[model samples]
Target: LEEETEIASWTENGGLFVGTNAERLAEYKRFAETGKYFGIESHVLSPSEVKEVHPLLRIDDIYGGVYSPGDGTIDPTSVCNAYAKASRKFGGGVYENVGVSGIEVEDYLTAGSAPGRRIKAVLTSCGKRIETPTVVNACGAWANEIAAMVGAQIPLKAMKHAMVLTEPIAGMHSGLPNVRDHDLSVYLKTQGDSMAIGGYEQNPEFWPDVDPGFAFGLFELDYDTFGQNLAGHMQRCPVIEETGIKSTVCGPESFTPDHKPLMGPHPGLRGLFHACGFNSMGLMLGGGVGRELTKWILTGSPEVDLFSFDCARFHPESVASSRWVRDRTHESYAKTYAIVFPHDEALAGRGSRKSALYDELKSRGSKEPLDYDLYGACAESGLAFWLVDQGAYEEGAWRLGEADHPDIPKHQSHEYLDLVEGELTFDWPASHATVAEECRAAREGVAIFDQSYFGKFYLSGPEADEAVQYLCGADIEGKRAGSVTYTPLCNSRGGVEADLTVTKLQDSAGSNYYYFAAGGNTATKDLAWIRKVLEDQNFKAQIEDQSEAMTLISVQGPSSRRLLQSLTHSDMSDESLPFSGAKHLEIAGHPLLVLRLTFVGELGFELHTPAESAVEVYRAVQEAGAKLSQLEGIPVRDAGYRAIDSLSAEKNLRHWHADLSNRDTPLEAGIGFTVLSKLKRTGS
Candidate 1:
C-alpha cells in the first residue's frame, strides 16, 4: 500500500521464471520450457521508454517492456558471498565445503527414567556428534529429506530452471535495463558487458515428461539455437544483435507445492525448525524470514505470517500409497509459482472454499491486516486482494493467513469470544484497524467500550503516597495532588500481573489516590494481590473496591485535549496546564473523574468519571474532539500478539506462562533488576 513509498518500485532482482505459454511451448520443442510471462525493465534499466531509450528496436516487433526505476539486476553469487561474509561478521557458526549424511530421531520427545530420551545427538558422516537443544534445517533444497528423517513430512520439491546469457555485441552498451515480454513469458536483463537473457524456456512445468523422474539436471544448450528464440527480442533492443555469444546456467530450482517459502517448526517433530522451500524467490524474502526464524527458536512464537506456509498444512498421507512421489510432485509444479490458494480446506472438519474472496486470493496477492479491540483481542485479518492498493490497513498483517487465528484468551476466567454475540472480549489482532477507529473516535470526541469490568481500587490516608510506594512499583512520592503515573506492577514472585495508572486526587474533602488497572486478570488480580501484600505489612492506608461506582473510559488520541477543553474550563495543553495530570472537573454540567492520561501512547485522557456520567463524558469527548480535527498526536498503535511478542522480546519481558520455562530465572530472562532491585528491596 505504499503508505510512505512506492510498491511498484520494489526490486525484482532474480532472473528465474518457471513455466511458459502455449505458443512458446511449440517453438522450444526440444527443451522443456515452463513458467508464465514476466517481462520487466532489466535490473535498474526502465522498460517504459524502451524504443526511445534503445533506437535499435522496431516498435512493432517489440513487445511492451518495463520502465521500472526500482528494478535492478544483481549477481546471485555476489549476494550469497555477501551473506556468508556477514554471517561470519557476527558470532554465527558456519560450516563450509561439508556434506551431511543423515540424522537420527529418538521416536519421541519424552524422557525415559534414565535421561535424554527426546534427542541425544546427531551422528555425522565424519563420525562427529553435535548435540544441542534444537536443530534448524536451513539446508536449502534438502530440507524435505531432513524433515522426513524426523518423521515430519515437508512439501518440498526441486525443479530444474535455466538462464541464458548472450555474447557481447559491439554496439551493445552496458546500461540496458532488464526487459521481459509479458506475453511471451521471457525476460532479458544485462550483466556486466554481456546480456543475461533467460526465461526463454517456454514451459515452467517441472516434469519434462508426465513422470517426475523423467530427467532432472541442466541439459546442454546450443548458443545459435538460443539466439534464434530472441529473434523478436532484438527488435526491442536493436543493440542486442551487435553482441557475441556467451554461456548459460540451468540447475534445479528448489520448489514447494505452492511456490511460497516453508517456515516455522516441524509440527509433529518437537524442537525441529525448517526454513527451506524458497523456490527461486527465497532470496527476496530472506531478511524478514531470517529474523523471524531466530525469534521462533528462542521463543516458540510461530514465524510471522508462518501459518500459510506451515509444513504441516500438506500431508503426504493424502497421496495414494500407489502414487509415485515424482508424479505427485510434478502435478503440483505449476502451483509453486501460481497464485497461492489460501491454506484452508485442511483444518479439522473444515474444508470448503466458502469464503467470498477465496478464489480471488488464489489468483492475486492478498492484503494483510492487523486488528485489535481495546479489551484485548489482537487479531490480524486476512483479506483477499488481487492487486496492491493504498490504505492504512493495506500491506499489514490484516490479510495474512496466520492473522485469522482466534486470539486464544490469556485468562480462562472469562470466555473471550461469545458464541452468542460474536463479540470478542479480549484484545485481538484482526480487530486493530477497526479498534484504532474506535480509539480515534474516543480520542477526538469520545467513545466507550464495555469498561464495565476494569479493576478499580481506592486507597486513602495521610500515608497514601507511602502506602502506594510500599505496595506498588510507583514512586507516588513525587506525584503531587492531581498527578498520575502509569506503572506496571510486578507480582511478589516477579511477574507483570498488572498495568495500572495511579492518580492522586483532591477536593474540599481530602486527598486520595485511585488506581485503575487493565481489564480481566489485569484488574481484578492487581487490586486483590496488592491489597493482600499491603495488609500483610500492616500499612495504615485504607483500601476499598470502587469497581461498582466507576466506569473506565479511556478517551485517548489527538483530539483528547480539545474534547475535554470544550466540556470543562480546564486548559489541557502542556503549555496551558500539563500532562500525566488530572483533576475532577465539570463535564457537560456534571462532576467527572477526568484523568488526562492515555494507554494508546497518545495525548489522550482516561476519564474515570462516575458510571452515571460515563455516557455523557463519552459523548462530550466525541462532540468536542470532533471540532479539533488535526492529526496532532501520534496515532495509537496496537499491532497484536506478534507485535507484542517482538516488544516483549526486546524488553526482555517474559510472559508468565509462555516464556517461563521450568528453570528460567529473572536474571536469565534479564528482568532481575525490575524485581529484586525495585520490588523486593525498596518495595512492600
Candidate 2:
C-alpha cells in the first residue's frame, strides 16, 4: 500500500492488550504462553510498565497486560483498495457493483460409475457468465448463501458489530497506539484527532440473513443494545464520556463455530474453494489469508494444522440450524478477548444428538450425554467434583482434594485419560457421594454404570468364524456357543488394532455368528477398520453395526447377581451361567443379551438390551438394587467411569487405546495368555 501510490492512505500504528483485573491478567499470561508456542514475540507487563506501554490506559484497576510489539492497526478501506488495484495490475478481473446469483456445478461420470460434482461456471446478477475451471467463494458475509447454492454447508454466522468515532479531541494525534482492554471488552484507536472505540458485548445481535442487497452496507445505529458496550468503553477510558457525539458505524462480520477463519477448499465439492468466515479478523489477516489460499490452490495443501479452521469440521446439525450458528457465534464474539483453555467446549447449542434414554438420564441430573450425567447426579446429594479434560486427566485426578484412590497411576498412561469428552469426578465429595465410596460400593456392594455407548457389531454367515479367525489374534474357533473371550484385533505386524470381547452365538442353519463389543471412544474407527479388513480379505461374512440399536448396562460387584436375579427368572448361580458366559434372557419382561465379563476385576454382567427397552431395564435394576439394599444391607449405586478406571487400575487392567494400542502386540500387552495357539491368526 505504501509503495503502490494507487492506495497509499494506509498507515501503521502499534496495538496493545491491557488487562484491569486479576482474571484477565492471568489470561494475558496464558496469551504469552500461546504467543511463545506460535513464535509470536509477546511480553507480559506490570501495571507500571502497562502505563509506559500505553499512557492512555487507566492502570488503577489494571493488574497487568500483554504487549505485542509488532502488532499494528491498519485502515481496511485503503488495504482493500490496494488489494483490488494489485489484483487488476496482475491481470485479474475486478467486478464492482456486481453480485453472484448462482453457482453452476456439473457432474462428470467416473470410471466407478459414480458422478463427480465439478463447478462449471458462475452466474452473476449483472447477467454475466464467468466460465472457469475453478471458482473461489470469497463472498464475505454472503459466503454461506453462495455455498448453499452449490449444496455445501458452511457454518458461518454474521454478527452486527458497532464502533463509534469520537469528535476531535485536544492532544489526541493520528499515530497513537491501538489499545484493547479485554476485561472491559473494548478497544480504542486514534482516528486523526478523535478516537474510535468498539466493544464485543456479551449478548451480540445475529444477522443471519445477508443477501446481495445488504452487501457492503452498515446497519442502522442500535443505541439501545449498544449502550452496554458503550458503558464498558466509557468505564475503561473515562475520558471518552466527555467527548461529543460523532459517527456510529455498525457493520456485520462473519464468524465460524470455533472463532477461526475458513480459508481452504471445501472438503466435499471439486473446483470450489472458500476464504470467508474471518471472525472479524479479516483486516489484520487478509494478506496472510490470501497467501495461504494461493498456496493451497496451487500445491494442494498447507503446512499448518488447520483442523480448527477446516470448513468441513462442522457437522450438518451445526450449520443446518441458524440458531446453533447464532448461539456459537455470539459465544465467539463475546469471548473475543477472553482466554479459552485447551479442550474447552462451548456451552451453547449442546445435546443436538441424544440417546434413547436421554430423558431418563436427564431426569437423573444428566446435563450432557455421557460426561456430565454422573457428576450432575452426584451433585444432587451434595458432592464436590472435578472434571478432567483430555490434557489434564492424570494431573487433575491427583489434584482432586483429599483423593483416596491409591491405585491411580502416576507414571504410566491412564486409560481414563483416553476420554475425548471430559471425565466427571466426585472425588473427595463433601457428602457421602465420593468416588472412594462408589468404588467401595462396587467392590463390597453392588454398582451399576451406563455402558450403553459401547461399540457393538453382529457378524454372521458360514465363513464368520474363519473370517474372525483371520483378523483376530486369538483363536475364535475354540469359543463355543454361549461363550465369550477377550481378544485383540491385530495388524499383520502383530500390533493391536482394538481390544474387544467377542461372544460366540448359536449357529443358525449353516451359518456361524458372533457378537463383538469394543470401547466407546474408538467405536467409529473400530467399525471402519473392521469393515475395511473384511473387505480386503474378501470375507463372505455379513456384518452389521448395532451400536445405536443396542444398550449395555453393567451391574457389578458381589451383590450384582442378586440385584439382577431379583428381576429375572433365570438361574443366577455360577454353575448355571459361568464367567465369560453369554445368555439370551428376559429382564423385567424385556429381552436382553447378558455377557459375564469384568473391566473392574469384579463379578459383573453387561446386560445388552434394545434402545426402546433400556429405560425400563435400568429402572428395574435400580428397583431391584434398592430392595436388595434394604433386605441384605448390600447397597446398589450408580458408578461413574472414574471409579471403573480406579478399580481397573487396581486389577492391573490395561485400557484400550491408552495402555494398549496399535503400537502394542498381544504378547507385549501381557494378554498373550488369552491368545490360543490352536488356530493361527495373521498377527501370530
Candidate 3:
C-alpha cells in the first residue's frame, strides 16, 4: 500500500476555477452553492483578482472564477510514508513484494437461521497462510481481482491515465495554487520546481484486464492519444506551450461506474470490505474516507449517508459485463471534469439493466427530450423535479402566474401521460382536453394514469414483517394483512430517508411477506439500504426488487369506483375495499394486485399487473372508463404527474426529497400522521 508522488507539499490554500464564458461561469457560481451549504468559504472572483491569485494566467480570455480558500493540494507520498513509519513504530506488520493470493471463508447459519459468510483465512503469494476474521480489499488497480477471490464482484475497472511534468520554467511559483478549468478539461499544479498538468480526455484509454504484473508499472506513452489533453492544457495556460516537456507519467487507476469511490462492506460477502476504486481521487479523499470507513467497520454503519459511494449501488448485471464496466468507467473518467447537470443520463453503458417494457416504451417514442443546459441552474437549487422555466405552462408556475396574472401559456408538458398511438404527444388530442381540463376530469370524472415507473419491491420470508417494522417509521406490525401503510424509511437519526408505501401481503403462520413501493429514483438508494440492514442485522428475509417486473396503472376521480366495477367482479364499495385496503383480483383475465390508496387526494386504486399483461389491462380499463364517462356526461381523460402534483399540493401532501428529505423529520415536515410514536422511531 506504500505509494506516493515524488513531491512533498501540503497547503490549505484553495485554487481558482476559471472559465471563459460568462453564462458558464454563472452556472458554476450557482453550482458552488453545494460547497457554500457545506460551510466552505467560496466566492466569485473577479478577472483582476484572478490575476492576483495566479498571475501567469491569460486574463483577457477568462470571464470569471470561483475561488475556495480552504481547499488545497497535498503530496500523497509524504502522507503515506508518514503513515507507514507511524504504523511500523506501533509494531504493525508491513509485508513487501507479497500479495493476497486467495481468501478462505466458512459459511454458517446465524441464530435467526440466516446464512452468513465469514472469512477464515488468507493465503499470500509469499507462501504465508494467515488466519483472519476480516479482509479489507484496498488493492487499487487489482481490486476487482481481489474481490473475485472471495466470490464478490466489485464494479471497478482500470483506466490508463497520463500526466505531464514541465521542465522547471522561469517565473514558476512553487506555492502557486492549483488551477482547474473544467471547460478545458485540464488541471495544473506546481510539482517541485516544475508544473504538473493532467486532464480527463473524452476518449480515455482503459485496460481491458488488470494483470498482477501491471502493478506499479507505466503503460507505453501514446503522445498522439495524449494530444487531446495537451491541447486542453495549452488552452488553459498558454505558458505551458513554451515550457519543454520533462517527462510523461502514465499508469492505471481504478475507476467506478460513478465518479464516486466504492467505500462500504461488500454486498454479497461478509467479513470482506472494499475501499478502492477512488477514480483517481484517492489522494484527495483518502483521509476522510479512512475516518468514515473506520467508523463503519467498527459500528456497522457510518454516520453519513454514503449511498453515492456504496459498492452495492451497482448490481450483478453491471459486474458481469466487463465491457459495460469499462465503458462506464471511461465515461466517469471523462466526465470527471465535465459538467453533470440534473437529469443528465449517461450516453454510455445503458440498456444493460432495463425493464421488460423498455423496448416497447422506447419504440413507442415515450422519451422526453431534456435540455440539461437550460434546466441545470434551476436544478442546482434543489428543484430538479420541478418543471423548468419552459414548463411553466405545463405545471403552472404559481409564483409567477399568481403574481403577474399573465396570460395562460399553452400546456407543453406531457411527460407522464399515456402514449397516444404509442407516442408521447405534448399537446392534447382534443383542444378541450387541456391541463386545466385534465385537472377537472380527475376531480369530477374518472381518470386513468400510468404509474409504470414506480419503484416496486417485495419482501418475503418468515422475518419479513419484523424486518420492515424495524426499518420503517410507522407501526407496520400493527397493520392488518392486505392493508397499505404509508411510512418513511428513517435513518438512525430519524430523518426521512425515503417515503414509501408498504402492504402486508401475507401474515399467516409460517408465511409472511410485504410489498413495498417508492419513487423510481429511489430504486437503488432504498434497496441498497434495506440489503445493508439485512446483512448487518442478520435478518431472515429476502428482498425482491420488482421495479421493472410489474407495471402499475392507477384509476382515480369521483366515478373511478363505478368505472372499475363495470369491468371487474370484485367488490368496489368503500366498506369492502376501503382506503389503504389491498385486494388481489382479476380484470379481463389479467391478475392484478389493487391498492386503494390515493396520491392525488381522491378515491383511487393502483392496479399492479404483470408486465406482460399490463397493456391488456390498461386497454380494458381505458375502454370501460370511456363508456362510463360518455354515459355520465362527464369527461373521462388520462392525466400526467403534473396534474397529480397540483392536486397533491392543493391537499398539502408532502413529496419525498422535495418537501420531505433526509434532512427533515416527519413531524417537522407536518406529516406526523404518517408516523406512529408507538414504533419508538424518534431519533434521540
Runs in model 3 lying further than 4 Å from the true structure? 1-9, 86-93, 110-118, 359-457, 460-467, 489-499, 507-512, 518-548, 554-566, 598-603, 624-673, 679-684
lDDT score of residue 521 within candidate 2:
54
The order by descending lDDT is 3, 2, 1
Local distance difference test values of all predictions, in order: 0.47, 0.70, 0.71
lDDT of 2 by residue, 284-372 (tens): 77777788778667654444334345464454444676665655566567767665543234444444434465567557653222432
Q: Model 1 off-target regions past 4 Å?
A: 1-48, 53-66, 109-120, 200-244, 302-304, 315-684
Q: Between which residue pairs do clashes occur in model 2?
A: none
Q: Is candidate 1 or candidate 3 better by TM-score?
A: 3
lDDT of 3 by residue, 179-258 (tens): 88888888887775678888887667767767887767888778876888889888777888888998889988888877
Clashes (candidate 1): 72
Tell me the deviation in Å of residue 234 in model 1.
6.3
Model 3 TM-score relative to the real fold: 0.79
